[model samples]
Target: MTLTVRALRAGVPEDAEAFARTRRATIPYLVCTAEALAWEAAHAPAGQRLHRLLATGPDGTVAGCADTGLLAGSTAPGHGFLHTAVPPGQAGRGAGAALVAAGEAYLAGLGVRRVHSWVADEDGARRFAERLGYRRSRQARFLGLDLRHAPLPELPATLPAGVTLASVADFADDLRPLYEADVECAADEPGDVDVGATPYEVWLRLNWGRPDWDAGLSGVVLVDGRVAAYSVAQTDGVDRYWSGMTGTRRAFRGRGLATLAKLAALRRARAAGYVHAYTGNDATNAPMLAVNRRLGYRVVASEWRHLKAL
Candidate 1:
């Protein structure tokens, strides 16, 4: 069987669908759709140097996909990412190696000297990464809750004085405050590569414009009429829901506002007929992990960040 790896035809509907399908099949925990994939290819920031690669077999069917791009918001130079995936039954057909080679070549051409990738914490995946000169860096856990069966915490009958909960829709006219809050929270989040201040226009196109982002279901906590904490919600337009981000402002920490916002978001999600919820957190983030556990989330899978220096 002849195999080929090349840049994905972004404008082709079938290629976008195949890319999304491969991602979903390999990493079911993350949210991926044809529209999201196409949007990413079309709207990536200029500095990202994004490259979407696909591996196809003789039959013209996509066997694997890789998303390679420079981390535009990272403070360090030459930092980039390459996420490659091949469906379970399609492994060992040279698809993975082809995708990785293509991804690395593209990033190298863009002058990227360090590349990072997330590998499932499984024996095969770990061995494969190690064989390719990638070393383990950090660990992240994927958590899930059966929204239909798990007992979620009930929202307090009355919020703390000066604290009011509202949907993200409440900030439709202006999202500057929310953007500021997100930047603060993201700067402090634990990760191998620091995501520095994300610009407003970039945030608007990448986060806010996502097809799954549900403004109505997303919860925001206002303290004294100021945005203090928030939980961004995304739905598959079906039963699956995911938490894009849940953070509290620096001054508002330790007050349980993040928990309150997440609880409120989940309640709205459940009421909207979502039956499952998923989220991920760095293994070193103990505080967030505790919050998720308290909310009845269980570890579904773990992934390790692997880095290779070019």
Candidate 2:
């Protein structure tokens, strides 16, 4: 079984399908679609040196896919993120390793200083990264809420005096404020990343325009008509819901707005026929973790962010 990597060009239907397939196979717990795949490949910033590649079987079926690129917003230039994945049944066919090799080489040519990738909380994946010289850095978890079985929390009857809950769609014409709030909230997230300087245009394209993002289902807590906290929801157009992000602006902390927004989002998700809701948080994000625990989310799996100086 000879495995080879090929570039996934924009506007190519097969490439988009392959990306969707590979993502589904490797990470069925999260949301993924062809539209999202195409959007990422087409809209990546020009300076990022982004490229998506697919590994093909001898019969031309997609075996896996990999995305390699420089972290556009990194203060440390030459930092890259390499995410390569093979479908569950296709592992050990050499597709994953080939894709990783291709991705690392691609980043190396672009002068990338380090490469980081996400590894699942499984023995095989952990071993794979360790053998490839990647060292685990931060641990993150994916939580699942059985919306049909898990009891949903009730919304708070009163806000923090002037705070209130609202739908994100109310600000469809002006998402800049939400973006600003997200940046501020994200800076406090525990991670190996410093995402405080996210660009508005980039966020607009990569996040706001994502195919799975449903503004109508997303909830925001507004204080005096300003966004205080929000929970963004993403669905795969089926029974699965993924939490895109949930955060509170710095000043709104301790008001429990974040919990309120998440509860609203989860209720909406259940009404939309989503039986399962998925969310991930850094191991060190105690406040958010506590919020999720209160909403009946249980840890389903964990992933480690692995880094290697290439």
Candidate 3:
């Protein structure tokens, strides 16, 4: 069987569907869609050289997919990502290897010095990544809440003075506050790379405008009319809810606002008929991890973010 690697054709429904299928087969907990894929390509920042690579089988069917790009948020130059996934049962047939090779070559061409990839904490995936010279760097866990079965805890009542639970929709006219909150909170996250230089317009296009973002269910905690904390929700508009990001403003620490916002969002999501809620946390994020654990989220899977010096 002839295996060919080529650039993904944008605006092709079949290609998008195939890409989503492969992603789900490889990482079912991660929510993806044609809209999200297309939006990413269009809205990615200038430094991020995003490319979607596809591998075709002998009969011309899409067998694997990879997304390679520079991490725009990284403070250091030359940090890149090469995420690859093949249809279940198609791995090791040269599809995964070819996609990895193609992705590495593309990033190297752009003078990227290091590449990071997320690999499922399983034997097969770890072996594949190791074969490509990727080594485990940091670990993360994917948590899911069975929204249809597990009742989300009610919004906490012990909010700090002048604080009230609200939704992102309440800020329909202006969302720069939310962006500012995200940038500030994310800057403190534990990771190999630091997220830097967040611009309002970039946040608008990449985060606020995502098709999956549900402003109505995305809960925000307000203190004296200012955004104090927030938990953004992204849904498939069917039965799944994903916590996009949850953070509290720097000055608003020590108030259980982050947990309150997440609980508010999850309660709304459950009421909206979402059967499942999913999120990921870096292993060292004890505060957020504690909050999620309190909300009944259990680890469903683990992934190691691997890196290789190119």
Candidate 4:
């Protein structure tokens, strides 16, 4: 069976649908959708040099999917990244290899000096990437909480003095506070690369304006009317929920504000009938890992970021 690898065609709803279907099947812990796929393709920042790659069978079935581009928002340059997914049943047919090859070539052509890929923290997946010259650099765990059955920690009858838990929508009139906090927290996050200061407008378009953004379910902790900690949520408009990010400002750590924000978000999500809640955390982030542990989120799967210099 021959698998054709090429850039995914824009405006083709079927290709987007197939890519979403294949990605969701490959990584069940995260949420993906046809609309999100198309939106990402159309809205990528110019600096990102993003390209969507698709592998299709002779019958037009999507065998695998991958996207390659610069690590947009990264402070340092010459860093590229790719995300590849192949369905379980489609293994061993060279679909994954073909998709990754196309992505690397595209990035190399764009003058990228290095490429980062996230491979599942599994024996076979690691071996595959290692064989292709990618060395594992960092590990992140995907945690899932069964919202239908997990007992979320109780919210205090009254928030700690000078603090208020509010829906992210409450700050619609001004997002600069949230954006500033996000930038600070992102800089401190443990990762392979440092992110440049993303303009407020860029952040607004890429993060706050994403199709999956759910402001009502996202929580922000305000202290003295300042954005202190926040939990961002995304939904499939159905039962699955994703914690896009949960972070606390450096000035407001050790106060349990992160926990407070998460509880608010999870409770709101469960009440909205979302059954599963998912998030990812760096393996070395003990504070956040502890916060998630106390909240009943168990590690469901892990991914190792593998990097290769071109």
lDDT of 3 by residue, 175-294 (tens): 888888888888888889987867788788888778889999999999998889999999877787899999999898777889999999999998889888999999988999999999
- Candidate 1 lDDT over 100-129, as tens digits, reads 988998899989999999999999999999
Worst 10 residues of 3 by lDDT: 151-160
Q: Tens digits of per-residue lDDT for model 4 on 1-310?
A: 8989988889999889988899999999888999988898888899888898889889988889998899987767899999899898998899989988889888888889989999999898889899999998999999999999998988999777899889889988888999999989988889888777889998898987788889989999999999999999999998999999899999999999999999999999999999999999999999999999999999999999999999
For candidate 3, the per-residue lDDT at 155 reads 63
lDDT of 2 at 45: 79
Residue 79: error of model 3 in Å? 1.2
In candidate 2, where is summed lDDT lowest over 10 consecutive residues? 189-198
* TM-score for all models, in order of appearance: 0.97, 0.95, 0.96, 0.98
Which stretches of model 1 miss by more than 4 angstroms? none
lDDT of 2 at 172: 83
Q: How many clashes (backbone atoms < 3 Å, residues ≥3 apart in a chain or on different chains) does model 3 have?
A: 0
- Most accurate candidate by TM-score: 4
List candidate 4 segments past 4 Å from native. Answer: none
Instruction: Note the residue pairs that clash in candidate 1.
Output: none
Alpha carbon lDDT of each predicted model: 0.91, 0.88, 0.88, 0.91
What residue pairs clash in candidate 3, if any at all?
none
- Per residue, candidate 2 scores C-alpha lDDT tens digits across 53-172 of 999988988889988898887766778999988888888899888999999999999998889899998999999889989999999999999999988977767656777788889998
